[model samples]
Target: MTTLLGCDFSSAPSRRKAIVHAVGHVDRGRVVLQRQDRFESLDDWAAWLADDAHLPWVGGFDLPFGLPRELVEHLGWPTSWVDCIRHYASLSRQDIRDAFAAFCHQRPIGGKFAHRATDGPAGSSPSMKWVNPPVAFMLHAGVPRLLGAGAEFPGLATGDPRRIALEAYPGLLARSVLGATSYKSDEVRRQTADRLIARRTLIHALENGDPPLMRDAGLRLRLTHSQRDALADDASGDSLDAVLCLIQAAWAWQLHERGDEHWGLPAFDPLEGWILGA
Candidate 1:
């Protein structure tokens, strides 16, 4: 009953901002993808996540769980990273935004700030401070809930570490599938074709019984012919992002159950906490 979940997250808190994609794995290694259910708001997503006892899921979130230590120190806040995040949660989002902006404003234009350890390892920007990608906001918006929901923050360890939540980049899998091809587009016509291509590629990979997926995953998208036709009608991969997350989650589930815990590897900042996943 172990299932893997993925979130193609947004910083905003509307139903449109939260989409949950899950893949279920039975006793043996099988991949069963769940439907993409968009929530009405962040609270709805929280409500769903809070039901931790129901579904046996281990999730790989797309947002950063910790901030750069340097960033923490700059704010003259507690040296502990998790403490800083929990503190910010008590403040308004606007206040957090203003503080980060001021921090950045004081820095030199180029190489203005330090980044979270996850960012360097994942090739993503810091998820605690907004600048280019605004991944920082995503962390601000996302992590506290995971913690609140009792999802294991391996590094933080304030919640149930067994709830296992890792940080995964869907791009890693998409790159392997499409190989530098811009198969995921935002334009309607282009995105539609890319999605169809992605779907077929995934299906083909599944039928062949890929290593990550055994031949027994009792879950699927169950896309209708018309749904397939409709998915093809758009060029952006917002939908594709969810599907990609499903696949990524499946991959991570395989490792999480088997991988050795370093208590946080490579970028182990005792304060920020450890990074989990394969």
Candidate 2:
């Protein structure tokens, strides 16, 4: 079976540190077992994320799929940016660039374009950008790759929505464990120690059956002995990050199973599209 996947992402190479890890979903309650893949270059990463042969696993990637409604509408390409998005999906990379550029050229300063919060959570740049966070660059870098890879956009398309790709909020996962303590560690040396502790904390919480994490959620896990040990053993919550993606996947499944309309956006996003947690 194609299991769900969670990824701990980094735009930079990891010669000194692990760059990205695709944590695979295994037994009961995702005991992060195998590292699915890794990348030292964005080109290689983009190429991997775009491949269709590896999907149908409902990958909860740490990337933004849509721009803000405010930004899209402000640019005036299509009042119904959603519909425009559908059409935009069919365009080539160059075409998307030209159109998005035109949109920016028409807009004012301090507001080149708006971005999704997932951008920050995933460490990606604005979807409308071509530089800086280059999230616009990432979208340019990533989405077309998703399309090329034949990854389904459940929000936009109908077939194999099972290849489900959604914008995940890692903050949702981090907050559950750290509770707004600012667990993000960018200092290089501090990253390993911080990750190790976070993993320990989450394991402890999971063991005690923490309500927010274990009780209220509807999903269930069926972990093997090795799987369970692996989770606690991994110093970096790379496994946890993947499992966090899995939990978000479960949350998405729960909302969808609830018969949410408008692609589960109302429950997931009231102002934005289906945000995790609040």
Candidate number achieving the greatest TM-score relative to the actual structure = 1
lDDT of 2 by residue, 126-239 (tens): 666655434443444444455555566664444355466665656665666677554334455665655656666765665444626345653444445676667656554555
Model 1 global lDDT (CA atoms, 0 to 1): 0.59
Off by over 4 Å in 1: 15-17, 129-132, 185-234, 262-267, 271-278
Query: Candidate 2: worst 10 consecutive residues by lDDT?
Result: 263-272
The pairs that clash in candidate 1 are: 32-219, 127-136, 155-273, 155-274, 188-235, 191-235, 192-234, 192-235
RMSD of each: 4.5, 5.7
The TM-score values for the models, in the order shown, are 0.76, 0.64
